[model samples]
Target: MNDSKLECLLIRIDNFSINRTEILLCIHFEISTQTMLSQSNLNLPGITQNVSKVLTIYTGGTIGMTLNENGVLAPVPGQFEPRIREDMNFHDPTYLPQEPEWLVLPSLGDEKRVLYKIKEYDPLLDSSNMERSDWKRIAQDINDEYKNYDGFVVLHGTDTLAFTSSALSFMLQNLGKPVMVTGSQIPIYQTRSDGKDNFVASLIVAGTYDIPEVCVVFNHKLLRGNRTVKVNCEALDAFNSPNYPPLATMGVSINLNEIYINRPPLIEPFSVQLSMDANVSLLRITPGMTLNQISGALSASVRGVVLQSFGAGNIPSNRDDLLTELKAAIARGVIIVNCTQCLGGSVADAYDASSEIFEMGVIFLGDITMEAAYTKLSYVLSKHAWSLQDKKDMMKTSLRGELTVKSAKLNTANRLGNVIVMEKILIQNSSVVNSAIEEAISFDQTKVIELLLKHGAQLTRPPLEVAESLCAAAARGSVKRLQSYQTAGVDLSLPDSSGRTALHMAALHNSVDVVKFLLNHVDDINQRDILGLTPLEYALRNQSTEVIMILNQAAKS
Candidate 1:
């Protein structure tokens, strides 16, 4: 359901400049959306002033409390999303209009109240009482209802809200939507409680932003769910987003932290995962938590353990039982990651006892929240029985930017290999990345082949080299310079280093030109890179998220 002419015209183009590459992008959308992937060009009008569009899911929580004549803190029927809409009607005319798609989910039935309107999912209430199945169910409903909308806002109780938020953060895999989980420090019935401002602000932010990563937008602060900790018990700014920056800070006018919002395309394919390795345990290293206790957790079929070390990731040097068990656990392939109990400080593997833990094969999660470390480790272990190599690789990589990676240089500071690879390539190609396609606009039809050939690029490599380049690009995220080698002129299928070719690199990087050149001159978008990676696989791995957003966008033209 794309209004193409309206959309293309909205981009300020009066006519289609049939480039060797652009024709492919246009064709990609026409075919993909017209066919199966359901992807389309989401070219929204540029906002001269702010307007909000949001989908609010009202899951029963303490945030909406109002007292009955009995004076109990109970949830009001449906004030979360609707209240904000009503408030905006009177006070702030500048407040953006939102296309409200609000759904009231089943409520919390405590000793005080028996609710009717609240739709109980599974009849099991407490968030700590939440199972992985419940997590998936909530996420599934959110996806089902809000996938087409701009952003999502969920009203949740603060008690175990972090768990559901964190689980949803990991569970929703590539959840490229703005989600704000907020409830009240006081119920809606309270005359002076903070729920109104918090609820209003959460919807305000959700309606205006498109942060793909899941975050808890509470009080006036935005927190990465996995990084968030409910520090304050009774303050207005009840939750603090310590490790990460707030996506937006609302004031006289909304100040958005564009740096934190999803940097790539929005309409991309996402496969949600609610499963986690349950064989994971957390060991809070208190003075009484013996080495025997540590050993026992490892012995309990725990494939991974997140060690909450004292202060700056310090474990008890005197505790031989724990050290021995930790070492033995490593030998047995159990991943031990040391995270700090302190909220602010980072984990140091360079210090005395801390440094020694490194030698025992314990991975250091510097400054990462224990929730992040635990959930991330569970994510890692659930994949495969990790080797020492895999363990080290997992620690080094960014699983949702949980840890800050240190590199030798500032510019080449590699974080997630696959994510950074082609993004960096785009930076390197900034001189011509867009211009290359832009220039192709004026070229004659026959000149497309000549211009592409003149650049010493090729259609595609043999499947083998296509695979290799895909790996290198996905891992390093930057392509080593293309070589005008002996086999440069051969069929696009010739596989190189990691079985990758030009097509593999192009699509993965969303190098529109490379993608276009391959389409116009090479064989097919359907062809795989060296490692059996398709253009789509490269898009997912490289997170060229929005590049080939219209799924069949690459293949058809």
Candidate 2:
């Protein structure tokens, strides 16, 4: 091809207004060129081989919005694609060859080159206006192009991004490829915009990783779609998952939490269910909330209600009207799920204040985010074939990893045996062991310690003396055992023999959960050990990136 003809081909390839049919032809040309190059003996330098194609579905969000003549930011139809194509950050000048026949991105690490095409929606939507129909459209698009692309990206607005993400997670059943939902707090047209970074990172993650579930990518964090919530409207870091940890954190490199990413079922064919019941309501209870207010929320037409109740799902125990209203709602075939209003905690029936609500058949949401509860309830209720009881059962069961199962009750007989062993050990060495109970507690043998206390084992030692056991439990990464020790009145600030606190031990062992628990209970995070190393230093020494993040956040808090 002559220079002018080659330039025309490059311009056509870079044109974002072209339809999907034209993009497919460009892809075919690249494939044909690869075949011809392989058949001949010629080898091309700096040209990436084995490209991975990703489908970028621009559904309109803050990432694509620009300032109009009125100076208010709004979604400008047909603008996002062309902007990305012309941006230097996205289309590196070094990667654009003299011939410019194909568009290719730099390899993620040393993996296959990522090639992508944009499919913009006819009319862009602000995320606040996103509904079930829009979610179904996005899901259907992915389903139609499932086998043709390695992964997919959905550009969305941050306002209702979590809802869309959660809806898609349920809609895309048996998915075996990454589907990333991302948007920016600022428009890509702005000088200080976060759109380019979030967009590029989501593309790399979708094209590189084999994560087989819907996810939200924002502020350099990859979170499960159903678990995510929009926590901030103004900050750059806008979304968070309170109950669940992030699946990955992007820094100098993309650090993936492989253990948390869900794997697809073997031999299952991909499918999409676009239907969702829109009659669900989320009622957040406040101080002086009235029965009439609650009753109005659970109206006859509402199919499901996600009640964001007080701590541990407590309602107005003094108000019989509230209990009556909840019972009546359940009787009328309305599913009421009790989720905690607190940022982190589970809704349990352990408290007397919550007993009446539980007795009225209010289902415990068990540390699930409000986003997950609302979306899951809608998804479950959409099945017309399911009975009322079936819908309730599905809400309690985790279809995705949205909620965690409560821990099993401890075995009583085994506890008795452990208590006996501990009692003998305490009796055998009463004088030499200054704090036998403390030693037992440090090892996280809570059952033995509990039994010893029941049998009148002495716990008369000073609180500081029990610090060794706290450190031991932290090292073991036992949140429950650590809580038991904390409840037994151990001084969280006391240092062990080596002058290391529980925080240090948790950080050194890379126990992120334990470290988070200690941060709330511990007196000082900067307290150094014998070597003058704080918890942050220990985290760095052990190369625990997650622990380091926890400590840094705790320090800021």
Candidate 3:
């Protein structure tokens, strides 16, 4: 069958509650060709786009609220878009003739123009009231409209914004497009509110960048969604990613820290996992806390617990009863994840007091926030098909970049001159080699690359796809990295499956320095792609004047 028919079949299968044999029989008989044809012909969105279109899921938040009759800031549904229409910063009238309801934003200095439509929820929630069902609804909506939009923006309330972001990060798996969650401390209806800036920046980032991860864009900083926590209540900058670095910092120019951003998964198709087990709770250990409190938190219904331990994952030594209760819970199959109570730092056995807890089978999650820990446990435990041991193993793994694995060793090596630990990690897992190479290439870490090469780690070469290659990555504005590839004996003239070389990618991104560097190495400046376009043609299409000049000078030379 065709790609569209196969996609329709998957959707139909997902809608049914049938047995495996029945599903196989249905597929064998091809019983639904008429149904598939009708579904496929319903004006489904195609895969190509020239302009960016974003779907803003406006769930009720402080940004969309106004004073009700009681003079309290309450969410007023169906009123947000009208306010946006009045604000020139959000809506442009020039594109109204094309789509009356869709709001368009004028292109801002080299960024793609954004045309957005808002999907407002009925009886909008005050984020404090958001639940797991709400998270499932949002994830499902994004999946339902996945093909139509280039990216997504979720307008949420600051009260539980971190929880929502963390939940969505796990729900949306193998995401290829940007999904940005944003909110403001003040309402957009007010004159001096930060909502306008937050909302506008979110649309711009979602439209312009191909950041495949879920992110939170607040106060001009783009942070990974699962790593964020609300640090302040009244400040414009309310959220902070304490453990991870900002993906991009917005200033006079929006500077992207591309090394920290995750590339899309080249193998798996995008999917949404909406099943979340809500039978999880967080328990923070305090001084003089009784054993009954601990036992009460991990009651019969609770299947998982995120234990907030003392410094370095310690517990009170005198409380053997508390230990007994926790051990009993573990024996009863409760997954307990130990996290640090401090604002920063990982849960480790550095302290002698933490040794006993470590022996009790408590999983240590390094530097993960409480929000992430809770949601991760929920997501993991909800996998009913997986065995108990699988759930425990997954909690220790960094699936969505929520926690750092082996953080202590890496930090110690960086702080001190300890190369042995780093070398061991690199040797044990070849996957670390690719991440190491990416970092080295992006930051010009020559010594690090040399170390990896000395350890017998193979350098990644260009394959059929452009994104799969190091040269294409370098062409996005890293001349030093491109030189490193050339010095390492990599062939710079190899074209991707599309017959586009690094020079073509450099021309499209307007990387003048990269274009100049590749001119000396490439055999032909006039080499044409599968579309019969040269590097100069790509530069001309993007209006890249500097690259065009460099290519023209090279062509004549």
Candidate 4:
């Protein structure tokens, strides 16, 4: 049988609801044709012949749980695979990729194809019972199958999903493929379940994008694993990244924020670290806590401790016993890392209450989540080759974009030019006027516009003359400048003198990012310009492959 004939057979089976035996027979049959499958027939224009293969590691989670004999939801072994195989959405004959072949997504206009397999773990575990050994097993599994698949997905429980993701980010050094960890608040057996959507989105992202980081996908947002936290217990939107923005968002279309994603070094080889020290402890300080309570947490067996301090890494300076116990632990070679109790601020030594702890050799963790700090401490302590100071130094550095160093303010004057500076001087020296806002838009200074707005400058539509300049920014491929104007409340649908919107200008210049942004915000993408040309026509005329793909998807939606 040939590829086309096999596709035809699958389509017939799908339309008629044929027997499983026939589908199995067709899957087992060998193809002996030299005729290649063309991209046009598959509706994918730029994809290659090789299909992307994703390996899903299903470690017992709420996503696979079903009602057991006791009449309560539980992780039942050997049930998840059967459920997926029986569901039409997941196992439809037409949707199934030709054996070792590609399966196109109908919702995406058949632009991308994915081939995936599942590997379920034995003796399923609740997330609360997960330990360091389980993390080591998951890491080794990925390392063993690194060369066989394009990406990986781990279906995990929501409770410790963030910890597992953070552990994998450090364990899998120089990772080259996407490793997405996701699960659901509800089980798959229920009528109203989120598992199906979360799992399907994760598979698509893993197969298509080159994120190359440990990420958690939930409720349509893809977040970096190390930066994620379980924010809710009952809501479907369980995870959130408070300090960092999501790497991508899944909606009517997958919008990738490429600027924030961390790209690995191209020349480095992927490796896994299996040894993790489990001798770490975390302490959360409360008011009027006894010294014995604090000292007991730092037992002799513990090598590292993550101190959840009060407000900006502060300990009670008035209480000498608390400071003495911390200093005693440091003297005994215990590595104490200071993390903030708040959800979203960086730790600093500015407060007098926090100065004593800094003086006693407590390392500051800036904006590092508690989950990340705990796992990172264990990871670094397991490196027996590095010295004590080296381990402490690595804690402060950003391994896997977990932390960021405080830096000086940006030189806004140099980047924004003299027009912005003059506008600022005018605003600070006198009352705000409409001409300043117009000048800011003319000079492409978004910051100046924001400043004017902050100082009581009324946001009115720019005059007809500056509308041409708005389109000019789009043509120049300045997404940052365009975003500034959008932030300043400029109407996105305003037409230029030539009747061209920003989308038309972006399409003409082949500005892929700008085109995507405009498409997301523009009300009518099919609106024709004065020349009767839509953005799609402009993209087609310029042969902009990326722009055409985005616009085509938008048109389909």
- The lDDT for every candidate, in the order shown, is 0.56, 0.76, 0.79, 0.77
Each model's total of backbone clashes: 42, 1, 0, 0
Tens-digit per-residue lDDT, 1-557, candidate 1: 35874465335322533444444444443342233232121223322332334555666667655566887665555454455434432133222123122221212122111100123332434344655566677788667755455566666777767777776776666665677777767775456767777765665555544466777877667777777777876776777756667767766666776435432212335666656778888888888775566666787488888888988778878777777778888887888888888878678765687877887788887768877777777767766566767866876566665566542121122211232442454455543322232122111122332333454434332455434433333222222212212123334444443335556656555665445444554565666532345766766755666556643664554
TM-score, structure 3 vs. true: 0.76
Query: Against the true structure, whose lDDT is highest?
Result: 3
- Single out the weakest 10-residue window by summed lDDT for candidate 4: 30-39
Name the weakest run of 10 consecutive residues (lDDT summed) in model 3. Answer: 33-42
Q: How far out, in Å, is residue 14 in model 2?
A: 50
- Say which candidate scores most in TM-score: 3
Q: Model 4 over residues 336-426: C-alpha lDDT tens digits?
A: 9999888887788889998888888999998889999999999999999999999999999888978754321112341344545645565
Off by over 4 Å in 2: 1-48, 92-103, 264-266, 408-557
Model 2, residue 3: what's the lDDT? 69
lDDT of 4 at 461: 54
User: How well is each residue in 22-113 modelled by candidate 3, as lDDT tens digits?
Assistant: 55644542332233122213232331224577999999899998999999999876899888887788987765554577787965755556
The clash tally of candidate 1 reads 42
Q: What does candidate 1 score on TM?
A: 0.60
Candidate 1 vs candidate 4: which has greater TM-score?
A: 4
Question: For model 3, what is the alpha-carbon lDDT of residue 509?
Answer: 76
- For model 2, residues 1-557, the per-residue Cα lDDT tens digits are 34674565567567545556655554444343233223211133565455566888988888888778998888877776677767766765465365243345654556766667789897888888888899889999999988677789999999999988998888888787899999999987789988878988888888777788899999999999999989999999999988777999999988987546665312245788878999999888887887678888889999999999999888778878777777888899999999998888788998988988888789997888888888889899998999999988989987777886532122222223366655565566444233445444434456666655655555676545566656756765668767767655566777864567888878877889998888888778999754456999878966799998888888898
Q: Supply candidate 2's per-residue lDDT for 425.
A: 55
Is candidate 3 or 4 superior in TM-score? 3
